[model samples]
Target: MKNYIVASWILFIIGISLLTSCEKDPWKFDTDRKPGLYFVELADTNEISFDQLNDSTWTRKLFICYLIGVPVDYERQIEFAPIDSASNMKFGEEYKFSDAILKAGEVYCNVYLWAKRPAVEDEDGKRYCTFRIVENEHFVPYMYSTAFFQVRVNHPREPKWWDAEIFGAWSEKAFQVYMRYYNKQEVENTDNWQKYYSTVYGKNMYIMNDATWEGVPALFLPLLKEDVLVPVFDYFVANPSDGVDIPEWYYEWKKN
Candidate 1:
């Protein structure tokens, strides 16, 4: 009888374990029990710069991303419009967006900002607008309701990692080259490396009690290489822009 009780208890425990293991992951699913989406990198206001473009009619893009659910097999249109009262942007004079579409088999889509060079630049070289994603056949709103985009004639602020002795003086060309490889937002790239470090690329090297990251990260920690550095020099040589001079040391790198 004691052996029979032990066998029954074992069977009960095994049955419970099997049931628990087969249950769906609670954290992996959407909060609404349905598909949903949100704006990427727009927890707060972000800028769309015309600093790199020379054309009178220039363009940039904002991403409309999925916060939940997997990528679908077909395309879906994300419908949005400018909030008239909140937006200061003059539609034709300053900015307008192209089709907002989540492409086939993708989690996000582009809202193209087609910018026009205003006859007069906005005060402080910036114009602001807000857009909201509405209820659609594809997705329901998840967390963020609205996103802000600024049209700005932003000037490049040199990053702290830039060594003047090695790379020469920081210029627009070098900044653009760094951005192309560094793959970060413009404001984060220009700010102090310490502040940028806090969020991106966790510095958890030690195994013991030393886990919290503090006081600046290494300059281009995993990104510094000959391939990246070569482009900066190549850009200056290729786009010398009339009167500007190229630094003497950079004449060696053959464009690859």
Candidate 2:
């Protein structure tokens, strides 16, 4: 009887442990949780362009935009919408923007890839395009198409900020700092190309580097300052290919 009791106790303990372990393993969605900025890949459809349309009537639909890290308040956020109209296509027909509530802090923007109309000349001599939003059964909120895209936020505006010291110094001192940081022998050796590539293009690279060398000033300048390290790191981490061999003058000047 004692032996049976002991065995029963062991079984009970094992069951409890299993239950506890199962509880700890919560279900999770496959998403990244970086603190800022993200990109979402969109499906390609010919309907998003103006050339494919039979008539002047074309429309673009805004689909979904993806979130990268944690959510933030949208109240203070500013959205910049740029349409690709290089093909002599009208812009209005190619894109429309809309929003939907997913969960608290998690919202979605739908982008209709290729619904466009032809251009109409207005009385002021300016060309215009027409677009419409339709509700479809597959598309939630009926009569609208939705998809996700990559997005960036909290990005920097100044590329020079990464090399702020160089930007601020008198010409000689500034040049000296630039040479010290960018033209080191360690940087120029082509064998380290892999390191540079890994830094710029590797997955999650954006989170790794915070120096000014990482950013594209043209894109980041208006958003952030030169002294902020986070944006610089993000830029270099995402673009290691931008790394170059340190110039010969950098080494010579440093030796001097």
Candidate 3:
């Protein structure tokens, strides 16, 4: 009879433990907490040439969501509206997101903005577009953000005289050294060629004006400083096929 009573007590304790275990802490959405997605803005603005648009698609992480310690398992739709009414790009025509649904277990997703190349020209032959992410049922737009992203797509600028012959093919180490030597600013032309005048120390600089050298596409200079002579830029232009070893001039610049 005592054993029976002890067994009953054990069973009762087991039952009480089961009831306590079954009870769970309540979970409520923190209404006071401001949690939502935001534009990562990894790059405030992105620009790509038409050649880069070969695939007719470009991607930008226009939005990132905060992990609110809960999974947003529901299918949510995001709204993309243009701030510029007069912009040339048309929604559902020029560009679109490959997928609009924010899938489950995803903290962030990328908006793949795509557009077709049109055979047309407006003075510059470039198309400009701007977009902003809007709020939806699942999340709200992040505060303290411009909430806007800009895209500029255009054709690649024409190759300059020097670029046509030896832009990347040649080692421009000496030219780079010269820039550092003078502490000069590199001015870019419409053709995107780095152009600037020689420094006072480099007054005898050899300029490459014409396109051809030795009957080949060469770096030619219109102005050659006959009196002053810094043969660094000239030597590389003359010997495009040779490697650019560190010259004594570069060492001199370092000493100062």
- lDDT (10s digit) by residue, model 1, range 15-96: 9988886675565564445477787656346776666423335657656556467776777877766676777876656677
- RMSD each, Å: 15.4, 21.2, 16.1
Task: Please tell me which model should have the higher TM-score, number 1 or number 2.
Answer: 1
Question: Model 3, range 1-256, lDDT digits (tens) per residue?
Answer: 9999999999999999888766632464665553466555533354423342232444343344343334566656655566565356676676555575566767666556665554445324356556666666566666432333344444432223333222233334433433343332233221112332442112212333333334322122222111111344455456553555433443453356
Q: Estimate each model's TM-score.
A: 0.45, 0.23, 0.38
Write down the RMSD of candidate 3 (Cα, Å): 16.1
**Superior by lDDT: candidate 2 or candidate 3:** 3
What is the number of residue pairs that collide in model 3? Answer: 8
Top TM-score hit: 1
- Flag regions of model 1 displaced more than 4 Å: 1-34, 91-93, 121-123, 154-256
Going through the candidates in the order shown, the clash numbers are 0, 49, 8
Model 2 has a clash total of 49
Best by lDDT: 1
